[model samples]
Target: MILVTGGAGYIGTHVVRSLIRHGMDVVVYDRRPLPQPLLDGKPFLPVPFVVADLADRQALDETFEKYEFEAVIHLAGDIVVSESVAEPEKYYLNNVGGGMSLLAAMRRYGVMKIVFSSTAALFGLPERVPILEDDPVRPINPYGRTKWMFEQMLDDYDRAYGLKFVSLRYFNASGADSSGLIGEAHDPETHLIPLVLEVPLQKRPYVSIFGTDYDTPDGTAIRDYIHVSDLAEAHVLAVKYLRDASESRCYNLGNGRGHSVREVIATAEEVVGASIRTVETPRRPGDAERLIAGNERIINELSWKPNYNDLNVIVESAWRWHKGQN
Candidate 1:
């Protein structure tokens, strides 16, 4: 059986569904309660769930004891970059501290395989476009720093112990399940695609465009957005790769293409068939001009291909899900 930490979250929930679809017995371990709407569907309703934070060592140990997790997909961690900057301690305790507790439990339980949900923010102000895994690890904020720290710990754990892991440093993880059963739903949504979709949904009056003076084609920051399902497929593939191979690996997951902020808003408008009001604002602190992923390594190594590589497809999927949420 596979255990997915934070499986109730946006990306983790999609991964859980993909794992179940691939004929794997999956259990979700999350601090947040699983929404009933998520389980109101077909394949996901019967899946098991454990509600506990990763910081609680006793809870983690008890969970490991209760269920024999063959492999773990670690996704439970604080993700808001601004929040991380405001509360560095929260990031450290939850991301780094929680990761250590998980590792300890994994070591005690003898579960050697894990797939981590890392981020591209670890590259910080990238010296080059299409950031590679071997690039310098200079994270600009606490969020990226914590992810990088956990990745470094993973390296140490692999070397000292026999823990084999794959750290998938993902670019912008957007979109939702194609079926629209489960989608991105944060208390305060920060992702670009969903935030733009909210304008069409009438949830928000206008979308805030941060930093419209970046050195890009449209003078807006450029990013690589990958579909959530594609990311889930990559996770499954990483798990298979770990089961087949012995060495630890790291790969950057993305569409290998760049889309400016203006382009994304244009695409969202096209998909939603509505004008999304936008207001220009000063660049948020630690905002990079551009950050695209070098996905060739994962493509060649894992034989993974993204189906929803087009920007329109990504926004369309997100729009459908967002509209459903209304």
Candidate 2:
């Protein structure tokens, strides 16, 4: 069985569902309540779950004792960039501390496989166009720094404790499951695509563009958005790789293309069939100019291919899911 931490969250929900569909008996370990799908809703798939924080060592011990986990997919962490800046301690506690607690449990139980949820924010201001897996990781924000620190801890654990791990550095995970049954429903959403999507949802009047003087073609930061389902698939593949491989690895998950803020809005407008209003402002602190991914490593090694690469298709999937919400 695979134990998915934060399996009730936005990305976790998708990843958990995908894992179960792949014929893997899964146990969801999340602090939040189990989502509707795992809780007797439409298209329900009964799953064993525990509602407890990763920081709770007693909870972690009991969970490990109960479930015969072959591997673990750790997705429990704070992800908001702005919030990470405002409260660095909170990010450290959950992202770093929580990760350490989970690792300790894994070490104690002799469970050695882990697939970490890292981020492209590990690059501060990119010295290269499409960042590579072996680039100099200089995280600017607390969130990125925490992820980087966790990756380093994973490396240390590999040598000291013999833990096999795969750290996936995701670049702008967008879109939703095509079924629309599970989608991005983050409380206090901060992702650009979803925030812009709010305009069409009638939840907000206009979207906020944080930076306009960026060096990109549209003077806005460009990001490569990999579909969430694609990312979830990569985690499964990574788990396979870690299980058979002898060395720890890291890979970037993305569309291998760039889309600026204006481009996202334009594509979203085209998808929604309505012009979304935008209000430009100064760039948020720790914001990078352009962070696109060079995904050849994962593609070549894991045979990972993103099925949803087009911006319109990505936005359209999100549109369909959000439109269903209201």
Candidate 3:
């Protein structure tokens, strides 16, 4: 059986669905309450869901004791870049220390394989356009720093014991599951596509165009946005690869295309059938001007191909999911 941490959250929920689709027996563990939508009237295909904080050593031990988890896909942690800057302690404690706690528990239980949900934020200000796994990691925010620290810890663990891992450094995950059953649902959504879509629904007055003087063609910051479904597929592949391979590895997951702030807003407006108003603002700290992933490694190694790489396609899936809430 496989265990998923943070399975109630956006990406984790999608991963759980993918795993279930593949006929895999899975258990979800999260700190927050199991989202009602995930368990709504689904008694026949009952996927075991548990709410337990990873940092709590007793809870972690109990989780291992209850389930025979052969593999783990960790997706738990604080993920806001701006918040990480303001509150570094929370990121370090939750991302780093909490990850260590999970690792310790997994070690104790002899669960050797893991597919870590790492972020591209570890590549703070890239020296090149498309970043690779071998690129220098100099994270400017605590969130990225914490993830990098965990990657280092994993390396150490692999050397000490025989722990196989695949750290998939995701770049700007957006959009929703094609089934529309689950989507991005952060309480105070900080993602670009979701925030832009909210403007049409009056959830937010206007989207902020942060830093409109970058060196890009649109003079605004550019980011690679990959669909959540594609990311879920990558996680499944990582799990399969880890089981076959014997060593730890890392891969960058992205669309290989960058969309500027103006372009994204324009696409959202086009997809939602409305004009999106925006407010010009200064650059947010710790945000890079252009961040796109060099997805060649995963594509070449794991044959990972993103199904929805277009901005309009990504925004449309998000729009549908958001509108479904009403």
How would you encode candidate 2's per-residue C-alpha lDDT over 62-121 as one tens digit per residue? 999998989999999999888888999999999999999999999999999999999998
lDDT of 3 by residue, 193-280 (tens): 8888888889889999888888999889999999998899898888888877877889998998998999999888889899988999
Per-candidate TM equals 0.97, 0.96, 0.96
- Deviation (Å) of 258 in candidate 3: 0.7
Query: Which stretches of candidate 1 lie above 4 Å from their native place?
Result: 38-45
Q: TM-score order of candidates, best first?
A: 1, 2, 3
TM-score of 2: 0.96
Better of 1 and 3 by TM-score: 1
lDDT of each: 0.90, 0.89, 0.87
Error of 2 at 121 (Å): 0.8
Global lDDT of model 3: 0.87
Tell me the TM-score of model 3: 0.96
